[model samples]
Target: MKKFLGALALALALISPVAANPIIIPGDKNQRLIANNLYLTTDSLFAAYMSENLEQRRLAEMYVIGVIASSEGESWCGFKIASPDAVQEQVYIGLKSASEKLPKSRPAAAIKSRLKEILPCKK
Candidate 1:
């Protein structure tokens, strides 16, 4: 009986982290909603950046700065962007470089992956 109980406990412990969702930083319901919206906006801007209209592409770049600024006010996925300008620069660079590498990925997923590489929280 004790062996069975110990095995069950070990199994639950092993499964828990695998089942857990990535924690939305400093986690709160409101922050999760805001983060989700910001992620969506960033995705849209990425799509617009590919537009043939030069003006549309320029506007999309500008909008990415705004989205990054707003994201600073919400929860992040363990990124540690220091200032608004820094975030803007990082996002701009990510859009330019990372977008090319991930041609087949959804823009939001690609952006998120890029940002994670650029600005992970210090351990």
Candidate 2:
């Protein structure tokens, strides 16, 4: 048991630094670019919205819904959406407009920023 534990500690120590460093292939600049921009962007969200696949559309709607739900009750930019269907439509319109205007922005940030404009909380 002692020998096995020592070997495990030595193995983990050797693997830690390799895991910490990102793998960069020579002359593969695109790989580094992709690695840096791994998170969802508005362009991808717009693609999902325009996709013919039902699942893609559903997931995009859900993503918008999540952004809305998370921003609720915040005194600054909270919004009161009427119904699930209506909220989806309204937010989609907002997202579509935002995608056209700000394609490079993060979707969650875009949606949150538009919440007050699209569905302002009643004062």
Candidate 3:
């Protein structure tokens, strides 16, 4: 009985991490929704060009900065932002607009689409 219990504990330990970290494929709707929830919650705090939730805003800014850095020198999102500050402003504005017009829209996707529309790649 002790051996069986030890085996069960080992099995659970092996499975716990896998269960905690579910695979999220790119472009998956559910994955997008989950990712957007984080941004949307933070973006919602923006009021009159400032965020009411500074901590959340800081986190969102970091996330947007990372995305911008990753997209540098590429037309991945078809945006030609000239500066990091510009990119941050655009992302926040895009997120705010998305939250107003399409409250349930995925933020990353929405911001990408918005950037493509307003700041299309100049080729």
Candidate 4:
């Protein structure tokens, strides 16, 4: 359908790959992976910013609940991040996801670490 094609085109145009299955510092056990590419329906880059902000905020939601919340909310931004050689291609990189899913005690901490690599280096 025309709609489908248009949608595909829009997606390719805006989103560019930044990181893919990126391993955070401290080795595989300690590090985490981030979904580089993001897709937005309307808000575009602003939407991505909002999602990242929320993911950063919910660092202490605690285990399961936190992961669920992050998964449902904009934190993941509707994208799935995959781990290295990960069976599940749909990866969850939210703070809670990072904490619960990663080896680290805090997913938020893991996310921040990933962001350090993601965020443009300060001059």
Candidate 5:
């Protein structure tokens, strides 16, 4: 038992640093650039969703919905917010409206603000 404990401690000590420090590959920068650019405009967002894999598309759509839901409430844009499907549609329309109204530089903020006019839920 003593030998086993000593070996375990040694193994953990050796592995700890490697576990803590992640390796930054060269492509990580490019990936980050692409992701950052995705949120810059509704066109970019929609293009990425259409071009990326199904999982990526789903995540992008979910991100749009989450932003609207979080900024407002679950009952976003004056929609009933009854189910996921309904919420998704409302989010899509809101995003579309925002994209048309907002400029490219501040897409997220513009979208949020545009939503106020497009779908201001009565308190």
Candidate 6:
């Protein structure tokens, strides 16, 4: 058991990832890009999110920041909040609680974030 533990610890140390600066961007209930300048502010972003294609949404974010020429699959969607350090945690929560007007879309789905991956866009 001691040898196993030592090997596991060594493996973990060797595989550990280098951390980057943490950034959180506000997203709507649909987890789409609601920011006008950052994204087109279209239903497509929402639809892609509904389809669970979070990759697309992330791509859109990357486009906003010029990090990528265009949004492709699973790429980070670089959205800039109105100002630096302006983290609106409520925006996503409010959007989740609000009733939806879109037709036939399964009732309002809550937008949530997972900590491990930083897609920036969360739903």
What TM-score does each of the candidates earn?
A: 0.39, 0.57, 0.49, 0.21, 0.46, 0.21
- Per-residue lDDT of candidate 3, residues 1-123 (tens digit): 866865675456445432231221223333442443343432342331244445545645555556555654452443344465666667777877876777555555655665666567656
Error of 4 at 39 (Å): 32
What local lDDT does model 4 show for residue 11?
A: 58
Better of 4 and 6 by lDDT: 4
| Model 5 lDDT at residue 113 | 60
lDDT of each: 0.49, 0.60, 0.50, 0.32, 0.49, 0.32
lDDT by residue for model 4 (49-109), tens = 2244444223222232434345432333222343232211222343334433543244334
Model 2: how large is the Cα RMSD against the reference? 12.3
How many clashes in candidate 4?
3
Q: Lowest summed lDDT over 10 consecutive residues: which window, candidate 2?
A: 18-27
Model 3 poorest 10 in a row by lDDT: 17-26
Better of 3 and 6 by TM-score: 3
Query: In model 1, which residue pairs have backbone atoms overlapping below 3 Å?
Result: none
lDDT of 1 by residue, 22-53 (tens): 11122233343244333433334555566665
lDDT (Cα, 0-100) at 48 in candidate 1: 57
RMSD of each: 15.2, 12.3, 10.9, 17.7, 13.0, 17.2
lDDT per residue as tens, model 6, 1-123:
866865675455345431110111223343443332332222332333333345654643343233222321223333342231222232233223332443222212222221112335444
In angstroms, the error of model 3 at 120 is 2.0
Off by over 4 Å in 4: 1-101
**Tens digit of per-residue lDDT, candidate 2, span 8-49:** 754554454322312212233333433422465686776776
